[model samples]
Structure formats: structure tokens, C-alpha cells
Target chain A: MTIKGVLFDLDDTLYDSTTFVDRARKEAIKMMIDAGLNATEEEAYNILQRIIKQKGSNYGHHFDDLVKAIEGQYNPKIVTMGIITYHNVKFALLRPYPDTIKTLIELKKMRLKLGVVTDGITVKQWEKLIRLGIADFFDEVVTSEEYGLGKPNIEFYRYALKKMNLKGEEVVYVGDRMDNDIIPASKVGMHTIRILRGKYKDMKGKCKYEVKSLREVVDIVKKLIEEGV
Target chain B: MTIKGVLFDLDDTLYDSTTFVDRARKEAIKMMIDAGLNATEEEAYNILQRIIKQKGSNYGHHFDDLVKAIEGQYNPKIVTMGIITYHNVKFALLRPYPDTIKTLIELKKMRLKLGVVTDGITVKQWEKLIRLGIADFFDEVVTSEEYGLGKPNIEFYRYALKKMNLKGEEVVYVGDRMDNDIIPASKVGMHTIRILRGKYKDMKGKCKYEVKSLREVVDIVKKLIEEGV
Candidate 1:
């Protein structure tokens, strides 16, 4: 409907956080081993990734805790581990999928307010936004670290709508997660666009729209914007 | 109710996050003015707090964004602003109410599995648990940030039960927010306890049980745990 604003997700929607995280996890494991941990890189990587998968982000495992568990103490080792892991995984490898830039640029030209609603760590996520050089492209960025709440929680969606100064019906939320992203945004009356590329291999739901890639966002929004429904 | 597990909320239920957040907001405003932003500490505090209140925690004019806005670029000034604000607010002022620690210890002594089901940011929240020296008290922490979901969404409660390796009937979920906490826990087949500590004065609902303090939790569960039905 009028389409005053557009909200997008960061990881797995625009850029591939999985690859960056995988690389980071590998480096972290190496750092742990270098710091005298008995576990192999694969073992540490598996444990870290498992934590993220279960807890949503590996950073939840405080670097200090891991350092203590691995090194028997918390000291510069934790900092080194965090820094090394961060450098390895930090947005350098976060290649936005083909057509993401063009889609965002096109959306900007259409004068639609842009925002990001991501369930990501604070510092790392913002760093990615800046590094991608897409920081200014968004009118606002709503990260879970800042929100104290995350997706699938109506509070988060409501916050984004209020920040964008748009009602649920006036904005469209595009994301990849059916359980976390799509359902919550849709429940708040915001139209949802599910990106098909990420984890959803057999996603089925009541989404307002779906696209195979970020490139299709423009066309989908254009058509939906024209409908004014 | 063989109280297999007891889940507590971090902010305002076990500890008052509002007080901590208020302190942090005030400190952040001071930092902003000290850095020569046009806004006073009071004004800046009001603005930041307003953003959280009107927009929700994950929405609008984040501390980093605010620092960037004032400095006219991305700088550590914004990062430091948030760090200091959250630190002063949370670290200095956040404290559990009377008997909070005692109650938790008692529950632990009774061999009740303790967990935390909170709609709060994972990083800072886990920090709070550690700061309060109560991190070890919980068997699991189902933070919204970590879970990618929050209360009022039944899945969050269901996940908590799963983590506890107990059915909904086997555990009791407790929190302050009626809409976001108690009712949703009830819908998932978990018995609920509503703590009306006046923090959630606006909270309204018909919950299974209500108490003024967490001290009541032990008694409530003690009675319910004995009745099989």
C-alpha cells in the first residue's frame, strides 16, 4: 500500500553472514588451539556453531568464558581470541548477494524510507553496515542488541514501525526467517516478503509476497506499491 | 506440579532494569553534553529514553547512531556513549529486590531447576546475570536475543520447556509483564506466576497466579508441585 518505508534483514537476506561466521569460527578455533586448548579446530568450531545455532549468535559465548574454559583463565587470551575471530569473520567476507546493491539503490531512488531490522550483535553488525558502505542507505538500523528484543517478538516490529514513522500497513518487512522474521512482521499488519535463498528449504506460510533474491525486491515493491492496498 | 524448573525474568522481575536503564540514560546524556552536543544531559537522556519507550528497545536513534549524528560521522564517541550509558545504568543501579538471592538459593536447595526466560538483549543481559552474581543459578537462559523470539509468542515458552527437558505442565514460567509474559506462558500449557511489583503497573490480564514479590514463587510452586493435576 503506499509503501512509505521498507525494512530489510541483514544476515542471510542481503549478505551471507553464514560464510563470514564459518570463517571466523575456524580462526577462533585455531586461536584457541594456539592458546593451548586440547580441542581441534573442527571440535571448537562445531561447539561454537552449535552454540550460535541454539542461541542465535556465537558471540553469546562470552570470549572470556571460552578463554577460561580453554585456557583455564580469563586474560588477554580472550581479547586475542575475540580480536582474531572478529578480524577473520568481520564483514570482509560478507559479500552481498548479486543484485543487492542495485535493489537498494533503486529503492532509494523511489524515495522509500529504508531501515534494517536484524537480529545481530551490536558492534559487529554495525561494523558490517559501515564496511558495506550501505550505512547511509538506511534511514535507520534496528539491531536486536539495541532493541533488547529480537524478531518474532511483536515489540521489535512495533519499534521499527514507530521509528520509521509508518504504520504496519504502510511498510513492508522483507526477511528470510519464517519463524522469526516473517510471522512477527505479518502479525503486526505489515506486509511480509520472504526471501527464498536462506535457510528456508521448505518454508510454508501466509506471506504477502516472496522473492528468490534481493534483486526482486524492487519489482515486488513496485507492483505492490502500485496496488495501494 | 512437581516443580522441575523455575524460570525468572532478569529485568524488573528479579532485578529492576528500569532503574538501571534510567541511571544509564542519565549518564549517557551527561556524556553527550560533555562531548559538546547541543542537547543537555537531561534533554539527551529524555531523547534516548523516549526512543526506547516510543520505539521499543530495538528501534530508533540508537546510541551509536546518536553519537554519529552529533559527531557528523561514525566515531567511538557513539560507541563509548552507549557503553557508558548502559554501564552506569545497568552495572551501578541494577539490583535484585529483597530476598531475590535468598529465594533463588532456596529454590536451588530444593533441587528445582532454575532458568531465565527474559525478553532482553542477550549480551548485556547475560552481563547483568553475571554482575548480579546469579549467572550460575540458572540452568538455562532463554533470552529473546538468543532465541530470536520473545514472550507473547508461545514458541519462546515452548522452547524453554524443551530446554528444561520438561513438559509445559512440569514447569512454571514467571515474569512481570502480563501481556508479554504470563498469558503467553499459559497458552503453551505452562502454569504462570505474575509478579505485580508495580513496575508493570500497566500490565493487565487474568493469570493463573499473582504475587507481589518473588518470595511468593517458592510457595506457589511448592503447592502446585505437589498436585499432580
Candidate 2:
């Protein structure tokens, strides 16, 4: 029952993307409106949601596809407008939770294998990770963009396990989503931890293990390993 | 397939509690710091999450419990500080979505019965409905707090159907949770339409039928009523 590998979710879990994306949303909406499109801030969000349904969060690809989708009915100028606004938003606004760096440092010192399994746009996630300075802590990073699957998809979990060269039972997957992260990881035979600090903090009753802070995870894993469960 | 009654979720679908609660969180954390309990905003939030988990969101009853849980461990002064800040953060900010009132009006005009099935404290949710001015639209309202059961549990849905005096197949249940709303209702012979505007907007799957906006619900019900489905 010893955990030989650990998988972390990138967005909100590693880097606080809620604050990061709030700025991105505002800029993106202004660009859409200023470019003579009839879309409001709310409509831009609806468009983003539609894009996610179609493109699975690869912002590099989604950006162009969103413009084309809008251009199918509206003026094409909004595309450039959106691109410029997206670029002007600083990535430095992305902040890791206060304990994240210290916890990751402790996890690294423990010599456990580290992995990042996330549903995020390739360029955006990488940029944010690098900015947060914890990118180097991960031995393997699997993204929905690269792997062609998202969380709650068993195949994605399988792909991460394969890449890490670890059995499902040897890995502990931690994330903020109950259905997407905890349930599917547990279903795949990994010990799942629901982090009660991020977007899904208020969500209840879906994970095998729960922790309020990342620091607690190290102790929980040690206890589990000692108990052989 | 004529629709006899409609059921709705109370939290984010009919009332916008997400924004209100978010504002409350900001105020609560700031109060904790101002009361000298925490040095930074993140620490305050950490304490808040701890308090929420230990207390369980039980209609301000948990507020006292939250203070007791954190009392000797942290600063006792912060206990009294977060209460008024939590209340003033405005539960009333929750308003019916724009098409909500109009759609309910049209459904009322059609003479079909109406009801609500929600998962929350009844006092909190019913007050929400009344504040939002949609209380008059419901023939009967049921909450998990009243039954000690939450959805995906068919008993709660069954309770609502019995109160409305309608057979399962004679009513249409509209809600945003797929597993809870569409799946359970369909199992009990009720027609289900998955609303795409709220929590389930990002979810992918086939339900009985899917519609993007609340305005579309009126049309769906009208068609089924006309065809006598």
C-alpha cells in the first residue's frame, strides 16, 4: 500500500487559475466587444464554454477555433482583438497556494515519483507552471491536450500510470474535481485525495481521502503506507 | 407526453448563490485578518475552509460550532469577527436568471403544475425563492433538508411527484445535475430535459433532450403538450 508515485492536478491545485483566469476573461471579453462583435462578457464566457466542449482546453487551438466559430456569423476582426487581449494579460498573476511549494519540496525530499495529470491548454498550463517555479518538481506531466483525453476518462488515468511506470495501486492522484478527478482515479485503483482548498472545496462526499491543505497529504500518505492499505 | 408538473434545483439554477457565497468568503477571510487571527489572506481562507468543514453549512447554526472548533487553537477574537461579516455579505444577491421569470410565467400560462426539488436547508432555500419572487410559481417545494435525502435518490423525486398529485410519466423534471436530475427522474418514468445553463453546462452526454437556454423549456413543454406525449 506504499505510494510510489503522486499525481497532481495543474489548474487551481498547483497554480490558482481562478484568479489567473478572471483577468483573462475580462480582457478577452473587452477584445471581443471592441472588435465590433455583438458579444457581451457573458456571451464571451458562453463561447468559451462551447469551445471547451469542442476542443478540450487547448487554448492555442481553441483560440483560433473560437474566432472562426464567431466569424461564421460575425466580423473576423474580433479574432485579432481576442489574441492581443489574451497576450496582454500577465501570467505572473498566477499564484500557488502558500503551502504548495513547501509541500512539493517535502514530497520531493521523500523521493516519491511525481507526476502532473491535468486538463489544461498546453501553452497556458506550461506557462503558468514555469512561472510558479514548481514545474521542475514533476517527473512526468500528462495533459489532456497531449494525451487526447480528459479527467474522469479512465484512459487518461491509464496513460499517466503507463508513463510513470507505476501500478494504479502505487499512485495517489490528488485533484479538485470529485467526478472528474477523485471518482475516476479511485475507479482506476489509485488512492484518490480530494483537495479541499480549490474550486471544488465546497463539494462533499466523493473521494477516498480528503485533506484541507497540501501539508496534510504528506502525513496521510505516510500513514497509509505504514498501514499498508 | 404532455407535461403536468415541472421541478427545479434551488441553488445556482434558480438563484445565483455562487456569487453571494464567494462574496461572503472574501468578507469572512478579511474579518479574520482584521481581528488579528491571521497574518495573510490565504491563512484566513485556510481557517475559513477548516471552519466550514467542521461546521457543515447548517443555516448559521454552524457559525457557533465553527467558532468553537477554532477557539483555543487559533485566535479567539477572530471567532466573533467573522459572524457579522458572513451575514452582511448578502445572501440576497442571488437573483433569478433573466429568462427565469419569463419562462416560469409562460409555463404558468400553460396551466401545467410546478414544483421544486432542491438539496439544501429548507429555510435557506425557501427564503431564496421568496426573495427572488418565484415562490408563487411553485405548487409544492421539497428540499433534501426536509427529507434527509439528496438526489440521485429517487425517494426525494418520488416525494415531490406525490405532493404534486401527478404520476411519474405525466410530469417533466428539468434540472442541471445529470446523474441526480435526468438519470433518476428517467428511471422513475418521468421525462427529463437537461438544462445546459447551470452546473451541467460543461458536462457532456446524451440526456432525454438537451436545451441551452431556459426560454427553450417553454417550447419543449408546449410541443409535448400539443402532441400529447
List per-candidate RMSD values in Å.
17.0, 22.7
**Which run of 10 residues does model 2 chain A get worst, by summed lDDT?**
A73-82
**Residue A130, model 1: Cα distance from true site in angstroms:** 22
Q: What share of the true interface contacts does each candidate keep?
A: 0.00, 0.00
Candidates' chain A TM-scores: 0.86, 0.81
lDDT of 2 by residue, A1-229 (tens): 5789889987777767766666775786676676566666777677877886776545445545665566564222355456545644744366788989998988888899999988865444655665577766888878786788787799999999999999999988888888788888888899888887655788767565788888888988787788887
lDDT by residue (A1-229, candidate 1, tens digit) is 4888899988888877666766766776676576466666666666665556665563545454555555576443333445545654653576777778888999999999999998766665766775566766888888787789987789999999988999998888888888888988988888889987655635777566778877778888888788986
Residue A158 deviation, candidate 1, in Å?
A: 44
* Candidate 2's TM-score: 0.46
